[model samples]
Target: MARQTQALARICDVISRHAQEGRAPTALPRVRLERVSALTPPAGETLGPSVSLVVQGTVRTVLCEKTSYYGAGEFVVASVGLPVTCAVTGANKVQPYLAISISLQPAIVSEMLLAAPAPRQTTVSSVAQALATGIADPDLLDVVERLTRLLDRPADAAGLQPLYERELLWRLITGKHGQTVRQIGLPDSHLSQLSHAISWIRTHYDQPFSVEELAARASMSVTSFHRHFRAITQMTPLQYQKHLRLHEARTRLLAHADDVAGVGYAVGYGSPSQFSREYRRMFGAPPRNDAAHLRETSAT
Candidate 1:
């Protein structure tokens, strides 16, 4: 328990330093350490595939309709691209909220799984939602400590970072949520194939495509593709596309304050009224009003 506490403290120290400076203190790619504090609610943001650990205070993340809460000595894993809203639930000037995020590299995961023997499991599936779990084991905490320590020794990072990262992945793969990590790597697995199709849709969401074409890309029958896609992601392919479109439109509106019609067209919406209706349904406000409110909140 003492060792675990020390590990968490060390991680928090590094993240707090980075967050104050608004940039990482290390040269690592795709992984960032941060500490945050806020008195008001934050706008929903899209979190790509990543793992987050909280060293102090608490945070709540909502993915689609599912909500998860993590506190000190706990972690959350998001295995897919999903629209999520997250906020610091417990914070103040002194204690604040300390957290770190490491983006999951699918290729690294795939390589680790390939080099490892298959676990005794029936099948693999997409982990569409976020997962939160407590950290009870000391070994896992040690791996996290070593990873963070690399930031202090940039010279040793190239050789030792990969080794430590692999160990971290191994610990996660053998942990209670092992199946979720495994599903992301297995080729020809239903979840793996669907992830491919989903990735394509996300990248080309601006263009319209038919169900038949998407099914062909997944190499599954149209009926089979539709069923499996929804089963894995909790949303149909079309519904998933709608989520991506609306989320992207929201980003553009917030970033550039783009015109409603222009933002709608930019995200592949041909009808402005349809875009407004869908945006209202997803975000609880029309585009212009929502953007204005967001701007006001940010200013304060």
Candidate 2:
């Protein structure tokens, strides 16, 4: 038997070092490495369209009501950009959690699909949510293992990263998770439409919009849009907008810890008291207190 091309153990250590550098990319045009040494409490994060592989340890992420578990040798594919609550479910000093995520650019995926002579047909017909997890195949592991090696070589990464990243996506296109990933590129697909609606909401989060407007934009009936939107995102459109506003408020608060009321108003809060109540509800602390704590944490 031939030796395995991808050594999972070595790959884990490589990403661990990258994460330790304190330079984790929030989104990547190509490939990105992420590592976490200690288990952490669940926190909300907005993720782009991507596929993530667990090289070591474990991670648990909850999107809406759906909770996904990824252990070593497993993969989690976020079919579209989504707001999720995530945390390290398992890790230790001996084996820190290491993961690598690659952004799935729709244009690149479409171009690759067109250039291919025969794209493999996806076997999955069931509707997929924002995130799905599946066991990693050996071929995916091999290609991704090769991709990670480029992180250490700047010259090679510039030239060959695209090729390997394409290969990694190709594997997902043909693998069991192919259907879920394919949905992102299907222009008229339900997931794609929801993505469009999500983009609209995020852009105009400060402004009030109605369900009829969103439904029309997505080319979906009011009932259908409402049902599917909640099903896919685990929240109603209004709820999604609230979270988006709250997330933006939090971001702004990190910079101006003193402007709690201004931050709330800027994020679309008409009532300062309502803002404080909701802020406290979501963040587990009032706006001023939370911002102060965050500032204190950064200083120390």
Candidate 3:
């Protein structure tokens, strides 16, 4: 616990020096630091396979119906890409929120799986299931502080970052968050197979298909697929696809469109009325109003 406190202090100091407001990209790929000076409204975004460590303040992320909160000394891991609504809930002008994130790579995790001990579980339940946040232990916290210190010495990081990256991943598997990290690494695990199906759906979202087709793609029966898919994602396959479509449509609306009907069609919504209704449901406004608000925010 002493070491954890010390590490958090060091991490907070480094982040204060290196991270400006909002997300700051680090010298290493897939690593980022975030600083928030004020609480913000809830916003939806997609998070890739990664781990987020909150060194200060707090953030609330809602995935489907479940709301997970992460604060100082806590970390959240996402095994697969997920659409989530998040807000910076506990920051003020006086004390800002600070966080660091490391993107998880499947290839690296796969390699670690061969050497690391398997997660504790029954043979019937060997697959590592979906997990989110875990309180950081002293050892894991210590290694993370060392990893962040690399940002302090940029030249050495070029050669040393790979080593630290591997160590970080290994520790994650053996750490309190091991179960979730393990699921993401094992290529043959149920979560990985579901990830494949989700990937297929995301890439082909504009197209149509039934649950049976997606289930077959994942080599699972429809019932089994639905159960596990919903278990991990907190949404059914159709709901997931709808989110993808709506998110994509919203992105286009915010950035590239003057025609709401065109944006709707392009994102696979066949009917304009249906698109507007769903758009209102998701964004709390009609397409034009939301788009205008987003553009105005971006400009200012």
Top candidate on lDDT is 3
Full ranking by TM-score: 3, 1, 2
- Candidate 1 per-residue lDDT, tens place, 1-300, comes to 898888888877766655662225347666676555654354466556667778788888765666777788888665666556666788777877877777777788888897776665543342433343556368887888788777778798888888887887888777777666666666766667777688898899888999999898888999989887776666777877887788788779987675999999999999999999998987788899888887886676
Error of 1 at 46 (Å): 3.9
Please give the lDDT score at residue 263 for candidate 3: 91
Tens digits of lDDT, candidate 2, 1-300? 122324676677667656662226632245777766667555567877788888777888866556778788888887766777677888766777788888887876666666544545433234656666787777877887777877667677767878888898788776666666777777877888878788999889899998999998888999999988886677899888888788788779889878888998898999999999987877779988888776775565
How accurate locally, in lDDT, is each candidate? 0.74, 0.75, 0.82
Per-residue lDDT of candidate 3, residues 1-300 (tens digit): 788888899999888788888887888788999999887655677778898899999999877667888889998888888877778989876779999999989899888889998666544333334656878888777777877888888888878877888888888887766778888777778898898798988888878888998999999999999888987887898888777888788778877658999999987889999989987886678888888877775565
Query: What are the runs in model 1 whose C-alpha is more than 4 Å off?
Result: 1-3, 21-26, 39-44, 114-117, 122-136, 255-258
Cα shift from native, residue 6, model 3 (Å): 2.8
- What ranges in model 3 sit over 4 Å off? 92-94, 122-128, 256-258, 296-300
Please give me the total number of clashing residue pairs in predicted model 2.
0
Residue pairs clashing, model 3: none
Q: What are the per-model numbers of colliding residue pairs?
A: 0, 0, 0
Q: What is the lDDT of residue 281 in candidate 3?
A: 83
Candidate 2 lowest-lDDT run of ten: 21-30
